[model samples]
Target: MTVKQLSMPDLVDACVQLDIGHVGLWREPVRAYGLEATAKLVRDAGLTVTTLCRGGFLTAIDPAERAGALADNRRAIDEAATLGTDTLVLVSGGLPPGSKDLRGARERIADALAELGPYAERHGVRLAIEPLHPMYAADRCVVSTLTQALDLAERFPAHQVGVTVDTYHLWWDDQAPPQIARAGAAGRIHIFQLADWTTPLPEGVLDGRGQIGDGSIDMREWKGYVEAAGYTGPIEVELFNEGLWARDGREVLAETARRFVRHVIA
Candidate 1:
């Protein structure tokens, strides 16, 4: 069991207390402390770094910017390797400014993935495509469901391409469980992410992460499906809440660890 708070302040405390992990950090956090230092902190704390929070945003209207995105992502892969993380959560960016055609946006993502997949494979890391909730379809990601992510995954080698099923985004989806099961059967379940969904989104359709069992997600049933699909990986919790982030980082970590054990696996 892992609590994915993703706030810089709470990370190490979760590592030491929960003994699983508390955060899935972004590059900014890494940069803040310097990559090597942060990696050392994560290691010294004995936290299991599941997957780096992000690594892909290879969609841009300008050709040069798109190239830059891919180039930047390669560095992200390298950073993940340095951290000894085996997966880099790939968030396929949304459509370019003023674009409404989803197919075109999807093509951009697939193309970027095709270019990066082999590289990730060589580095002994897998790229996990995170399909955002439909609410973010227009601005954050075009692939807004597990089905769509799986479809894109099929285009690459299984060892190189996989999908991330975030509970916050997919819990409401009737088709998510089956697709997740299928992904498990196909050996494409790279990461199992959990985030309870709360009402009154903090970011207005952007923030809905809650502590495990604090919201409406039925983890017992969901975990059952994941196991039935043959996935026996770590369950990572990823949450983004201003209230949590504003608290003492260490306490946040300790509490998350307690709650994860109390509710997630109790």
Candidate 2:
């Protein structure tokens, strides 16, 4: 959510003005604006909904908690189908309360996927499992590498489940490139996202993603990796920086587009 500060209508207008034909939407804003209405808004603007951000967090030791997670994901799937986007990026959950079992936690995610994957497929959607950085392992996601994500995704059909190759999280791993190739060979690289890692991460590391070209990542290099892997889908720029948010949303959107051209496209 690079321009999370912008209202849905304003964001839509910005995209149209900037000739941004496709958008990756987050669930909160879409739900707040009314799902059907958002679907109509984007549809009427002739903008494609690229992918729905997040329908995971399946790790839970408690039975009721696990059921709630699955139910929420089902709603997310329905929302994705309603929004006409086939990809649902998942941030599989972390360890449950007082639990130190990482392996057990991941297994729960697989169990949830087994139930959710077919439901998603029935709605013309695919579940894209996104592995967060290892730093997020304890409380955000246990799948912290492309290899781990692929291990989970391979259990299901490629069309029903796949992995999200996000530069922000995977850039640190030397093994990611080969994993990208592996994912591509199986047609499981569902979506590719770009975000730069900046130094001196803020207290809230979640919002520390930097603007393209403003950090250490070679955006074009990562782009090349995904392309070499035969991922021809939309390349989404998803930043989470509070600094950018404090600035003008429209201006940030325009700037991000320019940065994409400079750092990724060129």
Candidate 3:
């Protein structure tokens, strides 16, 4: 009953060999292996895609770019549906470059999502708003807390909107546990994402998420709260560390699975 860390077939095959329980994937992984090929390999290899790690970032300075972002999100939603994945984790894009008004950027994000609600419903995918770290407020996400995500999700109904809880961004917030509980009570706990925080953050820290157990987060305690609130879904590992990415992808995934099972999962 522990969380699993899986990637595409090569990484997933490595994870399965180590007995990792589930995997989180992205569009590029599909593109690299081709969706059908990746899916079939996952089936034959006995791996499950716990969640899809992204499908947001509709931020732009002009109407045309905004339109393009929205269109891209729609395609991402459809891709999630096509893959038979249940949760579409959203990394809501932050303020447009050179934009000083955070609120204005948030409004644009909301409006774009409002427009996409109906389309997402038809695709049978729920848009999980994942608030990024406060550090990312300027360059990555304005939605930086679970409370904010829940509030925004309230604007749209359950059929269209939900909340994503990612430890990398939320683990330090005092309000995080209660927010996790609230998301569960409201049936909006659409996805549970995992990562640890490390020192010496990178220059472009959007990819700063740490591998499990390599940093300071206590996921066991974090998981206790979510489980207490009756959350019943796979715990997805989403490390974005440059070092891990620099290594062999298979070795990285395998070690991620090992740490996830030994430290984060029981």
Candidate 4:
């Protein structure tokens, strides 16, 4: 959500003005704006919904909690289908409360996927399991590497489940390149996203994603990796920086598009 500050209508206008044909949408804004209305808005603008931001967090020890998570993901899948997006990015959840069992937690995610994957397929959507950085391992996500994400996704059919290659999280791992190829070979590279890592991470680290070309990542290099892996899909720039959000959103959207061209496409 690089331009989360923008209202849906304003964001749509910005994308159209910038000639950005495909837009990746997060569930919160779409739900808030009324899902059908948003679907219509983007459809009317002739903009493709690239992928839906999230539909995971399936790690829970309690049965009720686990059931609720699956239900929520089902709703997310329905929303993604309604939005006409084929991909649903998943941030697989972290450890259960007071639980030190990382392996147990991950297995639970697989269990949830076993049920959700087929359901998603029936709804004409695919689940893209996104591994967060290891730093988020304890609380936000346990799938902290592409290898780990692949291990989980491989249990299901490629058309039903895959992995999300997000540079912000995977850029630190040298093993990621090979994993990208592995994912591509199986036709499981569902979506690729770009975000840079800056020094002196912000207070809560979650919103610390740097703007493209403003940090250490070689945007072009990562783009090359995904391309080499045969991922011919929309490349989304998803920044979470509060600094960018504090500024005008339209300006931020325009600036991000320019940065994408200069740093990644040029």
Candidate 5:
């Protein structure tokens, strides 16, 4: 589960009480709780750390800014290593402020990955470039498609750099199926998250995620595609909707469990 709406302890408790085998954690809560403490907590509970939420945003024009981003990612890599998870999700930063050079932004990502790839390998961590939907291309994430994520990942060994497949971000992409197969073949499909798409998006479009099977996307097809591509990892249910987060976290977790079986695993 993402740590955006719950304290780390609450998150861990809910997961344990529900017998959740794996969880995806964000960096902020992990830091706030004391990295070692949080890691130990999850370890003692016997839950697998699925993937660290993020470690990218490396697309910057300013040299200092770029350097700072790389340094931060190094720390993130160290954190993932400490947490006993090899996958560190990377959301390549969006366009530089007031700039329209999308190509330049993508190129900068390649450069940054060239530098950070070795660092991640040394830490025994794999960097997964998560391409946000095209809607987030300007403000949140520049890598906007699975193909693009794979392209960046292909530049490095699969073990060092990989890609994340989030159904919410990729359901609209017609090209995603072939790329998913390719990612699996190359051993670069590091993490898979499920979030259904819904309309009437909230402002900023960041927190409008829907629950599984509640939207238009065919989740069974998504699961079939990924499985056909040879991905047999934990399928994380990630929701960012404000409405959902406002409800009881345990209720949300219970419903998520129901939907995962009904819609994703069926």
Candidate 6:
């Protein structure tokens, strides 16, 4: 949660100095710290950049805006390549202002991918489409379900485009297990993230993610499902909780590791 007041140097120090092994990076912080420097830092620390936070916002209605998103995503792909991570998480932008054309927005995402997919392939990067909770369908991600993500991902080469499985977003869906298996079978499961689901979602519902096992999500079950789907990559513990953010970053990192083992692994 570097976006929640933590600096990149501190975040990197916490991971490397603390022997955390891996980290997921956001674009802004990477840019702010100088992308090459940050990449060198991580590499020198022997840390793995499991996935870059995001790339796609390809759901705009205006042709010009959509083009801009593509350009931005292209830059994101280049940055990811520089960071030495192949997976670039994609939070496809939500509906255009005052627009209810969900279908149109999704279609735009498909179209944009058609253009960016080849570019990503050339750079040896994969765009992992993250299906945010349906709650964000109108404002954050038009792709609301794993099935929908797969639907779009299947349209492109598996290596160039794929789907992200984040417990925080897909834990409540009844079809998640099957969809995960499907993604794995297709070789389209790019990254796996962990964040528990909790009540009293914060305003805008963006930063209320629960620490692992602190809420209702059955993380062990999902972990099993994900592993069963042949996903053996790093399981990123990504929490967006205000309380956690308000605490010492080291403490939060420690607790996240403990919970990940106790709830997600043990």
TM-scores, all candidates, are 0.91, 0.99, 0.89, 0.99, 0.97, 0.97
Name the 10 consecutive residues with the lowest summed lDDT in model 5. 1-10
In lDDT terms, how accurate is model 2? 0.95
Q: Per-prediction RMSD in angstroms?
A: 2.5, 0.5, 3.1, 0.6, 1.1, 1.2
Score candidate 6 by lDDT. 0.88
lDDT of 2 by residue, 59-173 (tens): 9988999899999999999999999999999999988889999999999999999999999999999999999999999999999999999999999999999999999999999
lDDT of 2 at 22: 99
Q: Which consecutive 10 residues in model 4 have the weakest lDDT in total?
A: 53-62
Clashes of 6: 0
lDDT tens digits by residue: candidate 3, 189-252 = 8888788888778887866777788788998998888898788888788777667766777677
Candidate 2 or 1, higher TM-score: 2
- The predicted structure with the larger lDDT, 1 or 6, is 6
Candidate 2 residue pairs in clash (backbone atoms < 3 Å): none
- lDDT of candidate 5 over 1-266, digit per residue (tens): 43356788888898899888898888888999999999999999898998998888888899999999999999999999999998999999999998999889998999989988999999889999999999999987989999988888899999999999999999998999999999999999999989998887889889878888878889999999999999998888888888887888878887898889999777
Question: What is the lDDT for 220 in model 1?
Answer: 70
Clashing pairs in 1: 4-237
lDDT of each candidate versus the true structure? 0.80, 0.95, 0.78, 0.95, 0.89, 0.88
